[model samples]
Target: MILVLDFGGQYNQLIARRVRENHVYCEVHPHTMSLDRIREMAPKGIILTGGPNSVYQADSASCSPELFRLGIPVLGICYGSQLMAYLLGGRVETAPTSEYGKTEVTLRSGRSKLFAGVDTKTICWMSHTDYIAAAPDGFQITADTPVCPVAAMENEAENLYAVQFHPEVMHTVQGKVMLKNFVYAICGCAGDWKMDSFVRRTICELREKIGNGRALCALSGGVDSSVAAVLLSKAIGSQLTCVFVDHGLLRKDEGDQVEAVFGPNGPYDVHFVRVNAKDRFYQKLAGVTDPEQKRKIIGEEFIRVFEEEAKKIGAVDYLVQGTIYPDVIESGLGKSAVIKSHHNVGGLPDYVDFKEIVEPLRLLFKDEVRTAGRELGIPDYLVNRQPFPGPGLGIRIIGEVTEEKVRIVQEADAIYREEVAKAGVEGLGQYFAALTNMRSVGVMGDGRTYDYAIALRAVMTSDFMTAESAQLPWEVLQKTTSRIVNEVRGVNRVLYDCTGKPPATIEFE
Candidate 1:
């Protein structure tokens, strides 16, 4: 296993993801983790992640020099490199010019294990103010850029490596190759980790933890929740009860589709209860427009509904949520600002009835969750289903949500999805239709009409945290717009959203 030591970097999780992609299991812990614990874990390798603070700061994050003496391969990145150099008697000072974004780097040591198959001259992602002015004694300068003298350094005999440029990000042209070399050639990892093994191990752990206890799963029927439900069922079988709440915010016919899979008539052994709280949720969401407020209301209301259901079953030992890594990070992790509240994460109420909350897939990213889902033998359609927020279509509508707005968005979304599938447009990470609050004047069959515009959104992203707008074929957009305007009527025009995740999120609200 590879251990990632986090120094509060934004891309720490991305480091773990890249390691896992090498088919080697990895986990991230804070830099403050005790050395004894690290020794006990005995990871094949250790990675020190980048951070915002300068290593020379009085309170900067650092690790013991003895970490290097442990003999386990260590790879330091950015601030991590600075810390390593500083702690090991190497000079680290403010760069004459701070390197940021993609920078051209030249390899100084062609024999370096870290750059085994990498090009002699390559572009790397650089983001650092402090530069490694000199390599520590016995460490070779492996790579360097114009501004950063010591872009990468390594002590091959000691199995210590440091890179000022970020190899975890995609901007580093051959970053994956560098990481693969480190994990395979340097650390000697077998690269045997697979999702199937994770599935089996997790099921065993879940069974052991919830033995003789009742687990009430908040089965949203999305990929995450579905995988969680099935995993729990495989573990505890009859001890698991899945409660699917139809809070009127789901996509077109989503509630029924969910029921058809997890309900009693379904193949699973767990008890399935479907709560049709459409009007109940609508009543609470009446006149609500603010996106955060809508998310919180829907989130709390979901808990209350589950509480009512749990009470019927006497006592539920645990409440299972499909909260994935993106939900946790975006909802706010440590110093990271909250992008938005995920209903299962930040939007949860202060009080919950269950004895404990269990999130089986909490640490896995979106694509990782899908991999685990496939490993658990979940159906392909469900496994490959587009990601849906827990608050459902509540966040997809811009303003106050009414039954009419829900119907309009749902029908529009269904048509949008249908057209996209019919067009065989692959590589779309997420695509859906949203209801815009704006109403415009237009002539329909010579009659003047003013109505809401349906905004269709499509993005291509590996991780949900960052995404780019998909450049869909003009014909596909035209066909989708034509169908939405003609069929699903709150009565007006259809618009395509061209914004990406930075200026705008995948969802409208």
Candidate 2:
């Protein structure tokens, strides 16, 4: 196993994820982890994650000095590289111009294990305000860039390496190869971590943990929830009960899809409960237009509903959620700031009575979750399903929640999805329609008509956190628009959202 020391880096979890993607297991711990703890872990290799802080700052993050003496391969990235340089008797200072995007790195000399089989000149993603001016004692400079001279350095004797550019991100085409070299060549690790093995081990552990006690899972139709439910059913069989709350905010056929997956004749043969809390949720959300407020109400109400269901089923030993790594990080599970409160993450209220919260997929990213789902024999459609927010269609509608608005958006969204599937747009992340809550005057049948405007949103993203608007073929958009205008009850007008994640989030609200 590889141990990733998190120094408050935005991509700490990403580092661990990349390691796992290479079929090697790794864990992320804080940089302040004690030396004794490191010894206890006995990881094959150590990785220092990049952070937003500088090592020279008054109270910036620093690790135990004895970490270098562990006699294990160590890799320092960005802020981590700077920290290693400053602590190891090298120079680190602020750069004249910060590098925040893609940059080129040129190999200096020698055959380094880290860059084994990599091109002499390659591109890498850079995000740092400071750079290492000099290599630490006994370290050789391996690569250099115009803006950052000491871009890569290593000491073969100590099995230590440092890089100013992020090889974990996708922009670095050969980043994963670099990681593989570190894990296999330098660290002497057996790259044998597989999803099937993870499943077997997790099931064994779950059986032991639950121990004849029953588990109640919040089985939303999303990939994470479905996978969690499938895993729990495999672990505890009938001892696990899945409660699916249809809050009247889900997409078309979403509830049916969930039922088909967990039904009696399904692969798991699990017990399931489908609660129709549509009116209850809609009544509570009546006239609420603010996005944050809507999320809060939906989150709280979801918990209350689940609490009631649990009471009905008697005492449940645990509450299972489909929480994943991004959810954990975004909810401030680590030192990272809270980006948003996910319904499954920070959305739980104080009234929950379950003895404990169980999240089997908590350490995984979205793609990782999908891999696990496929490993468990889940259907491809359900496993590769597009991401859906916990607040459901409430957030999809840009304004107040209403039955009419929900219906319009659902129908429009269904048509949009159908067209997208027909177009066979490869690598499309998410595509749907949102009710803009604004109407424009239009001429239909030679009559002036005022109807709500529908905005079609489609994005292409590997990770849901960052996305770019999908450059769908104009013909596909034309088909989607024509169908939505003609078939959906929405009287007139369809528009496409051209904005990306920075200025506009994937969801309208």
Candidate 3:
């Protein structure tokens, strides 16, 4: 496992993803962690992440120098590199001209261990106010950027490598390649962590834990839970019952898709239950405007439905869910101090009775989940499915989650998704459709002006923690706007979400 000492960059999670992409296991820990404790974790290597704080700041965060004694390969980035330089008796001074955004770096010595690759000139993502003017006694300077005299440094004696820029971010085109090279060349870790291997091991583990008892699973029709249901069915056939609850706020054909996956081609006995308690949900939520309250009511109602279905299944022993990693931040079900959860948080309620919970994909990220699905022979159409909120279209609607409101949001959302696919951005982070509480006035035809407004929100983000306004191609946006206004009635005007994820959230409550 590779250990990353977190100095609190928003992109720290990206650093972990980069390592995992190379088929190596990696974990992030607070920089306050001691070398002795880190050594106990037995990591293959150590990476110090960049931070908003500078090393020269008196109140700056610092870790013990004892890390060098472990004889592990160390890669320090940005602020991390500054700290290493400071500790090694090198000159770290605040630069008069701070390097931010894209910068060019030129390799100085090909013989340098850190610069063994062929590139003599490379573009890098640099954001640093402090510059390293000198290197410690045995350290050799490997490269220099347009601004910083010593952009990259290496100490072969200590097996330490440092870069003034972050290679974990996408802005650095060669960042991923550089990281892969480091994992293979420096640490001797083979990039062979295949999804097939993950499936086999997970299946074996699930079987061992679940010997001969029956299990109950909560299926939300999302990829995570659907994948979990399929995996559990494969592990213990006839011992699992899949339950899906309908609160009437679901998107168009969402329920049908759920039925298709769980009813047929399902490896085990799949039970499909639809509870239409939309009125009860809306009545309970009457005039209560808080977002958290809305989520709680939905969550509570969902649990009640699942419990009602589980009773029919005759006292199952386990509850399986498609609980993926991002669920932590999404659902806000629990506090994960590190890594914000997406809309997919905690799986069953505390009061409900079940022996033990089994989450087959709990350890896997979103990408890994889809990859594992394909490896298990699930169709790409189902496996590469777009992400949907577990609350269905309830939270996606602004005012009240009536059946009509749900239908409008679903249709608009589907249209938004269709055009986004047509836009063909290489790595679009997330997209969604939402309804507004207020209406706008407009003229439909020759005569009178009418009212109503629909919103289309989408953004590109490395991690859901922060996001940038997705500058979708104008032609695609215009086409999408035209369709929503023409095909979907009651929507006189269509507006795009230009604001990013700070002042605005992914979902407009």
**Candidate with better lDDT, 1 vs 2:** 1
Question: Considering lDDT, where higher is better, how would the candidates rank from best to worst?
Answer: 1, 2, 3
What range of 10 consecutive residues in model 2 has the weakest lDDT sum?
A: 331-340
Regions of candidate 3 where Cα sits further than 4 Å from its true position: 28-41, 50-63, 86-121, 126-137, 141-151, 264-268, 288-297, 329-343, 346-355, 398-404, 417-430, 436-438, 446-450, 457-476, 498-509
Q: Per-residue alpha-carbon lDDT of model 2 for 1-509, expressed as tens digits?
A: 99999887767788888899878899998888888888899999999988878899988989876788789889999988888888899999999878877798898865999999889999988888899998888999999889898999998899999999989877777999999999999998888999888888888989999998989999897898999988998899988888899999999888787777676656667778899999999998998888877877898898888889989998888999998987777666556666667777776676777788899998888898898899998989889999898889999898789998999989999989988898889888888998897889987789888998899988987766556888999999999888888887754998889987544667776
Among all windows of 10 consecutive residues in model 3, the one with the lowest summed lDDT is 333-342
CA shift of 1, model 3, Å = 3.8
What C-alpha lDDT values do all the predictions have?
0.89, 0.86, 0.75
**Where does candidate 2 stray beyond 4 Å?**
264-268, 287-290, 437-453, 461-468, 489-509
**Of 2 and 3, the candidate ranking higher by TM-score:** 2
lDDT winner: 1
lDDT of 3 by residue, 1-509 (tens): 78888786655656777898998988778898877788789888889888777787888878887786689999889988888888878889988789987788898887765556638888888888888888877888988976698898989778898999888876676887778767777878766676788899998889889999888777877778878877887888788777777667777777776777676665436655555666777676677656666766777666676667778868778878777755643443121233322323543445756777677886677788888888877778777666776766767777666666666777887888888887776566677878887786787776555645778877776545446677778888788889988888767788888986554667676
Best by TM-score: 2
Clashing pairs in 1: none
Error of 2 at 209 (Å): 0.8
lDDT of 1 by residue, 1-509 (tens): 99999886667778888899999999988888899999999999999998889898898888888999998999999888888999999999999998877799999987988999899999998888889999889899988888889999998899999999989876688999999999999999999998888889999999999989999999999999999999998999888889999998899998889888888788677799999999999999999999999999999999999999999998889999999887876787664457789999999999998889999998788899999988888889999999998999999898898999999999999989998999999999999998989999988899988999888899998877657799999999898888888897765888878887655777776
